[model samples]
Target: MGKGAVAAVFALLVVLVLAVVVVLITQGSVAIPLGEVVRVLTGRGAESEITRTIVLDARLPKVVAGLLAGAALAVGGTQMQTLFRNPLADPFVLGVSSGAVLGAAVVILGTGGVGWLAGLGVVSRLGVTGAAVAGAAAVLLIALGIARRVGDPVVVLVVGVMLGYLAGAIVDMLVYYTDPDRLQALATFTRGSVRNVTWDELQIISIACAVVLGLSVYLAQPLNALLLGERYASSLGVNVRRVHFLSLASVAVLSGITTAYCGAIGFVGLAAPHLARGLLRTADHRLILPASALIGAAIVLVAEYIAGGNGLTRTSLPLNSVTAFVGAPVILWVLLSGRSRKQAR
Candidate 1:
């Protein structure tokens, strides 16, 4: 894409994100008007106190959670694709998200579910996030270890899928053995939803996302170098080990924190970067990262809107249900287009 075209695409993505944020915040169960939404956001009085509370307290947090989770997942996916040199690689595909869920589940289940975790201080919340990061790190390390030993990206990809299944099976076992009453807390994490996040949790998520995401910018050049292969990247004075470590760290933090807060909302990571790559017509990380972030946020917001944010359904759908539609096709396209094979070579 030309410079002008890229700029236009970015502008459109930003506008779409903002529009969705506005619509989702205002048009929930109560259906506040756009003008009233603006007023409440701007500190001017809303038409009513209930509208203000609903927009500011209830809806705004959910939208922000979706925005942050989407961006984090997308950026992580972008890094994963580059690191693995596989088009289908992502937190979900690589079992990083599953790892995170397992970590949280251990903490949640071991401590006696959400109630016990709640009994602990804010440290417990941070602890959940920490466990999640640890889980993602474990999966990343295992997958990378396999990738190093086996040059075949296809084989590594299958390994990742199996790892994901193993982690999920463990989680299911935990759920099956655990108290039935405690299962209520696991529902959101299993299926994925942003409705349960609080301002406190958002504080942790936002800070973690912002810090890790900002650090990822420094990896762009090294990541771009890696796309040509590890030998080429090393030949260009990029320390392959350092680059891999940093990339995995970035991915771990991003994927782990999002999973901790929002559950394992799938596919945004796998799909958003691909969308950005097509939009920019280049694999440049500098452009792709920001574009993917915006695109990712817009996607989650739109998905949320479609999956009952409009208040059409009594029960809200899981985010994974919507994101899987976008992500699964990308996976098939990557495999069938021979991109996965090419990368493996």
Candidate 2:
């Protein structure tokens, strides 16, 4: 496809996603009309105050969180996939989510306060966010080390899975020994609710995701070069080590912040890149990274609508489950098709 055609299609996709989000904001159990939704958004409605509260104070932050988290995860996933040279690679493939969950759980359980991890003042939230970032960085460091030495993407992917499992085991052990009340709080972090995120917490996510995603755009060309092979990239004057560090740092921040707020929103990181690649018909990071971000944002917003946690359904589904529904199939396909194995070779 021509560049203009591809750009047009991507632009349309983003508009469609924004439209869907507006529709979703209006059509909850309360059933605000679309006209009112628009009016409230535009500051011209009879129920302006009520509608504004519902849309802005309540739903808007959640929607923003979903959008940023999804885009962050997708961009991180794309970087990881290219760095590892494996379609199955994703942000969580390095156990970042597991580490963040573990860190949050430790804070919640160790402090014996329900809100210790999530409800502390901004200072405490920042503390937890910092911990999550540190944990994710730890995992990323290990995963990158293994990826460099192993040179097999599938093996590295499996190693990351094992790291995640190990992190999970530790978290489970911590939970098993801790107070049950804290477990309840941990539940929200694990289940992945954009709803639990206050506007205050949203700021942290916004800064982190915005900075990381912006950096991803800056790194895109170098990443594309790196994708050709490390030696070739070095020959072309791309600093392989710097690229690796910056990329890993970006992934760490994106995954860590999102997990801290959204609670390990699985598979958007894993699935969105492939979808973007298929849609754009290219793996060149220049286009794929940003396209994945848009698609990821759309997917999360749509999933949030479907999860019905905003009083849209009698029973709400967890965001993790919703993402799993989309992600697990892609994972199975990669495994069964031997694509992962081929990438390893």
Candidate 3:
């Protein structure tokens, strides 16, 4: 697409993000009015203190969490697709998210004080987050190591799927022996939800996402070279090994932190980048990265609203339940349309 067209598309995405933010804020249980939402956000004072607290304390944090999780997953997915040269690669599909869940599960289930992390302060949160990142890194390194030796994208994809299943099995084993009372803490990790995120957690998520996302922009040019293959990328003066390591590390952090906070949010990473590429008709990471981020944020907000942000439903659905509707179709299209076959070749 031309620069003008791309600019217009981005503008529309920004507007969509803002519109969703307002809608989400307005649709919660208390149903705050748009004016009150705006007032609270702008520090203009709400019509009532209750309204202010609902917007600031409850709705706003959830909305922000959804935005951050979506963007981080999408950017990480975009890089994964490019790195693997596969149309279907993503954190969730490739087992990185499962690994994170395993890591968090170990902490939440193994510890006798299951509720301690929730009641404890930042230090506890960091500890769990660190464990989650370590798990994601483990899976990523194993997958990359195998991918290198095997040199077959299709084989690598299957290996990732198996790894995800393996991690999930281990988690199930832990759940089997653990006290049911303590299971509440681990419940959200199986299915995704942003409703539980707090301002303190948001502080950690925002800082990490901001730093990694900034680094993604710097990695874009080198990543583009990687799309041409490692040898070719090396010919263009790219440090292929360095780019591979940095990109993998970025993916691990983004997926791990998000999984730690939001549970296993399936398919946002997988779907968003494909949608961005289709919309812009380009594979360039420079454009795809930012575009995917916006599209991802919009997808999650819309999904959240459908999953019970509408306030009509008394019970909220697991985020994966809603996301699967979008992701499953994309997975089918990629497979049936021969995109995956082409990548395999």
The residue-by-residue lDDT of candidate 2 on 138-174, one tens digit each, is 8888987898899998789899999999988998899
- Model 3 pairs in collision: none
TM-score of each: 0.95, 0.93, 0.95
Off by over 4 Å in 3: 112-119, 339-345
Check candidate 2 and list the clashing pairs: none
- Tell me model 1's lDDT, rounded to 2 decimals: 0.87
lDDT of 1 at 247: 86
- The TM-score of predicted model 3 comes to 0.95
Tens-digit lDDT string for candidate 1 (295-314): 88988888888778558578
Clashes of each: 0, 0, 0
Ranking by TM-score: 3, 1, 2
Off by over 4 Å in 1: 111-116, 339-345
Q: lDDT tens digits, residues 1-345, model 3?
A: 789999998999999999999899898677777877778888988788888888888888999999999999999999988888777889999999999999988888886535666567777778778888989999989988888899888898999999999999999999999989878988998999998999999999999999999999999999989888899999999998899889999999999899999998999999999899888998899999999999899989999999995575788999999999999998888777786576789
lDDT, candidates in the order shown: 0.87, 0.83, 0.90
Tell me how many residue pairs clash in candidate 3: 0
